[model samples]
Target: MILELVRFLVFIFFVITSFMIILLVLFQDEQGDGIGGVFGGGSSSIFGARSSSVAIKITAFFITLFLFL
Candidate 1:
């Protein structure tokens, strides 16, 4: 039952994240501006635009999680 709950929560999280990703993509500027254009791109971007370690880490975590499930 606990495993099932985790799976269900993960499913909801994925669904919500998918929509958020789509919205963020749509908000980005096509020329060169990122979501930072709408938010703040130049001032606070710790990682560069393309090579974010955070993105890699999050992706790795999700992949491992999915596999474990």
Candidate 2:
């Protein structure tokens, strides 16, 4: 039963992460800056720059984990 619950949670996590990654990738420009410069162009840096750093890493880690799973 515990293993089954773990499997279910992992499945949900994987699906959610995949959806978010797809959304992020789809919304990004070919240059790979992501939907940043579209409207926040005036800023010296891109949107979600600093905070996105960690978020991106975490997303990447999850993606890798999902792939391995």
Candidate 3:
């Protein structure tokens, strides 16, 4: 039925989105440094160390949505 097809598509979309979000979240570096100071955290980061909180939040949201799907 149309409802079943819609449900299936929604499930697939959620699964794919969750996987992408997870990959991105994991790919982000947690260390407080850019490409240069990776080995040397002792040096102050020129751009400053940004927090991964946003990525974590997004990943969490995707996970919750995936579970609902």
Candidate No. with top lDDT: 3
Question: What are the runs in model 3 whose C-alpha is more than 4 Å off?
Answer: 30-52
Each prediction's RMSD to truth: 8.3, 7.4, 8.4
| Candidate 1: tens digits of C-alpha lDDT, residues 1-69 | 999999999898877666655554455434454556324464324344653435433444454454564
| Clash number for each model | 0, 0, 0
Q: Following a full C-alpha superposition, what root-mean-square deviation does model 2 have from the true structure?
A: 7.4
Candidate 2 per-residue lDDT over residues 2-58, each given as its tens digit: 999999998998788788778765554354445464345423233345433444445
Ranking by lDDT: 3, 2, 1
Task: Tell me the lDDT of candidate 3.
Answer: 0.62
Query: Which pairs clash in model 1?
Result: none
Worst 10 residues of 3 by lDDT: 38-47
lDDT of 3 by residue, 1-69 (tens): 999999999988987987877796677656655545423353533233643345544655676677777
Q: Give the TM-score (vs. native) of candidate 1.
A: 0.47
TM-score of 2: 0.49
lDDT of each: 0.53, 0.59, 0.62
